[model samples]
Target: MNSTAKNCAALAKRLTDSGLRPTPQREVVFKVILEKRDHPTADEIFARVKSQMPTISLATVYNCLETLVQCGLVRQVNLERAPTRYCPNLHEHAHFHDDATGQVHDINLPADTLKQLRSLLPPGFDASTVELAFRGSKGSARAKLAEGRAAARSGAN
Candidate 1:
């Protein structure tokens, strides 16, 4: 189907799967996350969502984010002394943070490398999830943003 139809179906499934009530605020918040995919902090999300949903409060955004996280529809990414960023990727991967721009990028880990890393653990050491974050320069971060913007523009046309 069309992109809009696909997005609506996906959003509906997400709300139902997460046991969320699918309120308008939550729907807007989730749409912002899906549209941006830039790992936005709660403040940033609130700002973007405000233009579309003028009546939404920052507190409501935070509550929606918390509910999404608790329901397993999103993951929280934390860096040293940095505000928590929300990520919707539930796959086994890592995050690369650009110190200069405060940008977060998803780095997909090799399956074999992940397996080897898991093998290094001692006996009876159980880990539910593995997340790695690296801090570095603006390498490739700018390119990714440009690509996202280009795609968005094309989709809008």
Candidate 2:
């Protein structure tokens, strides 16, 4: 079978395992999220789904997203005062919000780093999940130099 078919089958299996029936809307939304690893907001997802399934309503997209998140198939990344975004990556990682570009990048968290974070909790309080987000711009010298070179190259061409 083709990749799309395989993906649909996998989605069905996951949803069924989560005790939710997989519908076409849920499948499409999940596919869109999987297609683009970028953490996208509900509106962004609605727009993308609308293109393929013109009859899909924003409400339906929202419902599908809620189902996906509830079923543990997707994660909702909440940034302060910004729209909530969805992430398909199930691994343990943190998100870096770039203030300049308004983009979210996934930062891998090492096992020891996670252990250290969990260690900070009180003896009686156990943490199920730890979410760490850093808000800043990529203003490092290396990043600046790379941007300058790209601009110069583009201008030359």
lDDT of each: 0.83, 0.90
Please report how far candidate 2 places residue 105 from its true position, in Å: 27
Please name the candidate that would achieve the greatest TM-score relative to the true structure.
2
Query: Per-prediction RMSD in angstroms?
Result: 19.9, 17.8
Worst 10 residues of 2 by lDDT: 72-81
List the candidates' TM-scores in order. 0.46, 0.50
Candidate 2, superposed: residue stretches over 4 Å from native: 79-157
Evaluated against the true structure, the overall lDDT of model 1 is 0.83
Query: Which residue pairs show backbone clashes in model 1?
Result: none
After superposition, the stretches of candidate 1 with alpha carbons farther than 4 Å from their true spots are 17-19, 79-157
Worst 10 residues of 1 by lDDT: 3-12
Clashes of each: 0, 0
